[model samples]
Target: MENAILLLKHVGYLAVLRDMESFNFSKSLLSKRFEKMIVEEEKKKEGKNEKLLADLCECFVLLNQFCISKELLSIVLPCLLKVGLDKDESEETQKEVEMAFLALSNINEYAIIDKNMYFSEMKEIIQHHQEHNNLTRLAYHSAWEFVIKRFCLDGSLEDVISNELHFAKEAIKELEELMNCVDWKRTKEEREKESQEEKVLLRWLLTLEYFLGSCLLWNEKYSELIRCVVQVYQTAKGNNEEIGSRCIYSLSMAAKNRAMKNEDLLNGGAVNAILKENQLPTMDDVNTQISLKFLISITGRLKGKKKEKMKEEHRKGLKRKMFEKMEEEGYEDVITSFHGIFVLLEGCLYPFISLNVCDYFVNV
Candidate 1:
């Protein structure tokens, strides 16, 4: 059994049998092969052999094509979920559940999840497990990777994803709590960002960006989600360039929304983050491009322009109101903060708008 596990681990690392076209193993043959293996494992009192299950999961996930067939999925997914979703406190089953989650994260990426079969049911089950705190650290990440990727795939899942926005709500609640735990008030520090808690937060931020990258923010009902994104960008921007850049992309997406009220962003500490990134000389070319693009995106949105159809004057009104609010709050303070951000924003946000366009910057 150990030898078999060792062999599976090595082969999985090497990624055998990845070529789908002309691979000669018919889907039928592969499905039957895996199903047979699953049956054989079942016969051995499945939960008793957690190590074996882990290796089997590794081998199957490495194969990757095991899920290309609904037949195999029907046979295999239940087995994985049974072990993965187990809440039993037995030490014996821990490895099995861990491997089950890791495999599920890898495997579900290939799942053809329509709303019909694996999609809604798996979502419900995963959320239930999350609420119960049944997943290990790795399992928690793997499970949400499964959830986030489901909607992030090709645009076909739009209909399948409910407008009720369950994922958004859950992410906001969890992230708000997580955000509170961080010491955002501290100034920037130069150090390696490898702490376990920081790494987990980084992963969560990375996942949350995918949802924000889409047109999901365009929906008026998700205004709180936009605020949530801004708050995250504000509090967490100093963590790392990657985190800050990703939040920039998400904030850009939010800015592109016609429903975006500029005041929400400005008052949400957006100015503070923008200034911090502006001052950072460590940004490589890639992060610089990202920062510039975000500056352009936010500036354009602030000026009442979007690629999509909308009332230009209405957008103008939003921007106008934003400036008016800034005036009411006092322009000296606002321009002092803008001194860091607009040096980059003025040149690139539009071809037409330049340093000459905004009279407010005359003193700036």
Candidate 2:
């Protein structure tokens, strides 16, 4: 039967088969057979049928890819999650888990679209397996795709903002829990030894970056979220450039939001956390531009009353520090680092002009 299925795949027969009147009927029959086998395996007392179940999952994935049918996905998703989330500590089982997640990541969107009810179940499975580093990375990407497709693309800005804010709150809570699990006091060697777990942590940091950017308009947790981003930045800045850059970008987005300002960030200690490191490595051009824009926004937005002169002085001090850093880092160095020099020049120069123009009138 396996050879026959292979032959059908090689010959491209499944494409034709998927369009036939009997396609649904055959899919139903296969679903029933797999369901019965899974039930029988569960009833066993002595031996586990891990190999059989794994192979069944592999076949289901292949069949689903060929057919692209929602019925097959609904039948297979639960089984895949079961194997993927198994807490077995064997190398063989780990391979099965990777396979299961790879399959799940590929087909997750179909299940999400066809059965909106399965969205919560899918999130639970992803969250449950986050302890497994490899699976966690895959699950994050899958969840990202699902969220972007459902909330962002082709949607009104207001609707997108609403959905993103809702998801961001939940994502922030999950990230806090994951961050607490890391051993921050490990020696350099000990930290280097757990490369897989480090990757998982980096993925989580990137996910938080996405959530923070999405929640810029959400003022309820504004201070807390800024602190969280600052913490992630301090942790990742020296270790991983991509993660560090993302952290900066998230911070930049927050600073750009009207709901936040220089005072709120400074009060939360985010401004100090960002500026305290004088010898930090140079971020990529993109992150450099984002960080620069954030500085410009905060500086341009400074407002004060005659009675609040101390607050105004504090904001001015922060802006001076940002400008000094930009000069020491070399504005020309940043502009020339870009592959598209003209575009980068425009991005840097045009924004500054507009910001200064607005700042002049506001000050007047």
For each of the candidates, the C-alpha root-mean-square deviation to the true structure, in angstroms, is 8.6, 12.1
C-alpha TM-score for every candidate: 0.61, 0.48
lDDT by residue (tens digit), candidate 1, 1-364? 6786567555553343121222332355654575567557756753656545546655566556434466556545665666665777576566556666656655544466554445554666556655776655546665665556666665555433434436556566666766676554544553353344445455566665555565443444355665676677666655654555666666665554444555545655554455455445454444444444555556566654555345777667766765565455454364555556555554555343433323333223
lDDT of 2 by residue, 117-184 (tens): 34455555545454344344434444443443433222333233344334445445655655666566
Global fold similarity of model 2 (TM-score)? 0.48
RMSD versus native structure for model 2: 12.1
Winning candidate number (TM-score): 1
Question: What stretches of model 2 exceed 4 Å from their correct place?
Answer: 1-117, 123-194, 216-219, 256-266, 276-286, 296-364
The collision pairs in model 2 are none
Candidate 1 minimal-lDDT segment of 10 residues? 16-25
Candidate with top lDDT is 1
In order, candidate lDDTs are 0.55, 0.51
